[model samples]
Target: MSIRAVDLFCGAGGLTYGLQEAGIDVRAGFDIESECRHPYTENNSDVDFVEGDLSDDVSNAEIEEYLSAGEDDYTLIAGCAPCQPYSTMSNGNKNRTEDHEKWGLMDEFAEIVADIQPDLVTMENVPQVQKHDPYDDFCRRLAEAGYHISDRVVDCPNYGVPQQRKRMVLLASKHGRIELQDPTHDPDEVTVESEFSKHNFCELEAGETSDDDFLHNARGLSDTNKKRIRHSQPGGTWKDWPEELLLKCHKKDSGRKYIAPYGRMEWNKPAPTITTQFYNYGSGRFGHPEEDRAISVREGATLQTFPSDYSFVQSEEELSVKSVGKLIGNAVPVRLAEAIGQSLIQHIRNEDPQTQLQTV
Candidate 1:
């Protein structure tokens, strides 16, 4: 049987593109952000990009239509609901209560899975998601629908993503037991230098853009910050700076342990988690190892394992560092998604010997 899929909450088609790379026919992707349409449709031409809020009944119905388009297809519904409410980064924030609005998106995803009863389903989210009641509810509903469920937190570097991202992945199949594939890469073998060196990006100074690659543009840095990065050693913290360069906040005991800000990444290790603010030098450990600026938009996407040539916008005028960074940082690392796709295909083939699935 042919395998057909729909990706919900598909931001810039990262998951959809990865599944497609593994030979799944991902027919459609739905997201609320219209900004995603260009990248999603431009890259994955075969997949229809539907811009809408997935919480609406009409959206769910539209998803159902995509799944049913091919009668002989083995249907799959996959999604990674917006994870801010369940992310560890948001854990200690005072405004977490206000973030509850997104807590229901997972429930909406579950409702669709329960109603559609697709042959296979998968979801990827921050590891903290397991602690929430919505996660338990989502799993319970899948079990009630007769799915064989398996889930665990996975390190992205083990799957060849050049970042230190840990995500919770869940796989559910109606066709007997299913699980993610074992790590395909040795974490040590997937390093920042190994990946970024391959790109050989044109040398760019702070606030400069590559003439050849538009996305390879670095955010501007203040003069003080420039001197700070000049003194910053790879994998070294702000504590390494001279006394005068230290910020008042860093001088305090409370901020002593917070070493990620203004730190440069180590060449031999995976990069720190790519947050939406990665383009800003002061955000986390986002500064380049030798360059006097934060990682460029293209570099951030590379760390997320997006193909080097993946287009984020149609033209240079449309590019916004903040917007593009959010899309790239929030994306499911494409390599990790491809691994999930492989496992699902293998599970289907194992259950039905007559099925033939291909991978790119």
Candidate 2:
């Protein structure tokens, strides 16, 4: 049997690319962000990119058309519904009710699964999502549809991603029981230093861009921020800065507990979680371990396990650090997605030995 897939909420084709790498014929990707079209199409040339909002009237018939387009014998519907409402960062927010609008998106995904009833289904999201009712409802719907479901919190570094991102992964199959693969990497062995050593990064100063690779550009920093980064030690926080260089917020009693900001990643350790603001010097521990600047767009993408040559934009002019950063930060780490693909393939092979799997 041949396996085919369609990625919902596919951002920059990260999940789609990984699935293709593991031998699944990803026929198309559906996402609301029109900006994602270029990267998604450019990187995964064989897959179609459909721009549409899944939460609205993007019909299940259109999705079914894509999944059934090819001659594949097996089909998979994979998605990571917008996770902001269930994100840990949104806890205790004043405007959380406004964020709840996105909570219904999982219901939209579940409805697609229940209606289409694909051979397999999978989802990835922040670990905090499981504590919420939407996640529970999604699982309940899957079980009711007669799918065998398994889900767990995954340590990204254990799956060969060189960052400290923990995500909740789910695998459900109409075939039989399914689960993610065992960890392929030792956390300590996949450090920032080891991963960076694999890439030949052009030495760039704050506000510099490499002519060779536009995505390798670094964000500019203010003079004071430059001084702060220069004083920062690997694995150390703002507490290591001199009192004169401290920000007004850091000088206050309430700010003393916020130490991860204005810090540098430890060379021998995995990096802090990559956020949409990772290009900013004061956002988490995003400073380069030795360089006096925050990590570049390429560096951030690298930490997210996007291949070094993965292009986020078609040309230099199309690049927007803020826009691309969100896409990268929000992406499922490629290696983790590959692991998920591997596990699904193994499950299929185990359930039916006659299936022939192929890799790109």
Candidate 3:
């Protein structure tokens, strides 16, 4: 029997890569946009990429056409619906709009599961999404459908991604009970230095591209921020700055007077959260530890924990570091995806990689 999955809202194949690496035969990806097709299909030849508006007019018949015809296909349906609504940082109350998450994509997923009756199911999304009623309702619907559902919020670094990112993850299965993976790394117990020191990063330049696009890709800081970072120390905050460099906003009482703003990353600790504008040091403590520039495309990718050798295919003329940088920073780190995939695979079948590696 083949292990099968369908990645919904697949963005540039991050989760697709991880699941494939773990021997899951992801059949095809469904997305609303056409851009995702190129990188997703090009890199993941073993999988198909289907483009469509999954939240609208998409039907159970459309989803069933891809599932097993007769044999025990061990079907898995998975998606991370567009989560702009739940993010605390979204520009406005965009989550209020209809036809997106508002139309209940999770409910749509549940409806599909009930119809096709896949053996396993999963979803990954921003941590804020867990606070919404829809997520709880979706889980309830899954339980009513005779599936063992498990859900929880997780910190990405715990799964070996270098950045500090939290996510909501859920796994449901008809095969048996479902469970989320345990933390791979501890915060109080695991420092940032301990995460990447073992890897052979010495040959890697301070700012360079990795085969895997998600490693590190902070935008080059502006000249002004560059000058500021040149003087900034790792693990230190704005107080360390001289009076000449203080922004007028900080001089005002309303300024956030916090160390994270315009701060450099400390090598000994996990990176601050990887935000959409993570490339810009001004957004948070995203400045490079020893260099004058902001985090490079590769460094940000590293912070995301995509393996150094993982390939992100782009045309020669298309390496606009900025565009790819956003893709990587905004992407689910492939390793985090790997951990999720591996966890789900093990949970569904008692197939722990650690134990398998020991035997091999």
Candidate 4:
């Protein structure tokens, strides 16, 4: 029999893909977004899906129903709550305390775990979740319920994702103690050319792309920003841009502290942290290495470690990709998920040699 699991707050199934790749049978997903339903269901047909709020009538009821069903030792529940409250780059429009309180949602997750008492429990979130009260409470409660919990903040690129993102992850089980997976790649890391080169990888041509392709959209840059990027060679700062193109923000004394974003990406180093709005050159250090245009949505997804065809399904044709890219940008990279899956598989195998993970 396969190891069965559920993915909560599942976006476009990036985490699901990784779990599946690591040989766990993800049986279902729960999310409130409509866009997720199409690609998620299409990509993950073997798994049933529940649409709506994680705490709403349908999601909770369906969870209970599955736990109460005839099967036992076949349940694995994983969740990732909203990270907006912990995000460093919000627009400052939403009420932080009121609108983005998903730290408390861990309570809801704990409640379901307490009720269902599934054999395995897991969650992934931003590193900031550890500082909040709710996660601490949730961990305490899960331990009391006899689930041994192991938590850590892992750097994703170290596991072969090619991006630098850190996330807090948890793995718990009713059996014995569990540990996280070890790194597949060294912390020293690979270079940009190593990650996105067209030599071994596929091409990311215009209007079409694969997640593994070196994706770039090649949009026309504004005349001024264009000149700025043209002179902004690898590893150089805004000083590379002619004096005429310097922004007022760069002119301020305080701006000196923010030079990381105004410069070109270093050819020999990992790129800066990729954000959801990475297509906007102003959002982060997302300018092309040599091209005048800011990165296209495809380019942003590459930074997120998404394979070219992980479809986002949008209406604006151009902006539609942004939604998918944002989700990809915000995702726990599939490679990281695969590492987590590998650790959990080892834990299970240590207990029961009969349990098989198709992939190690």
TM-scores of all predicted structures:
0.97, 0.97, 0.83, 0.87
Clashes per candidate, residues 3 or more apart or on different chains: 0, 0, 16, 5
80-124: candidate 4 lDDT, tens digit per residue: 877776655542454664466565667888888887788888888
Task: State the weakest 10-residue window (summed lDDT) of model 4.
Answer: 198-207
- Residue by residue across 68-117, what tens digits does model 2's lDDT show? 74465789999899888888787768489345788888999999999999
True lDDT of residue 137, candidate 2? 97
* Candidate 2 clashing pairs, residues 3+ apart or interchain: none
TM-score-best of 2 and 4: 2
Q: Look at candidate 4 and tell me the lDDT of residue 33.
A: 77
Candidate 3 residues lying further than 4 Å off, grouped into runs, are 57-59, 91-103, 186-218, 350-360
> Who is ahead in TM-score, 3 or 4?
4
Candidate with the larger lDDT of 3 and 4? 4
Report the poorest 10 consecutive residues by lDDT, candidate 1.
53-62
Model 3 Cα displacement at 283 (Å)? Answer: 1.8
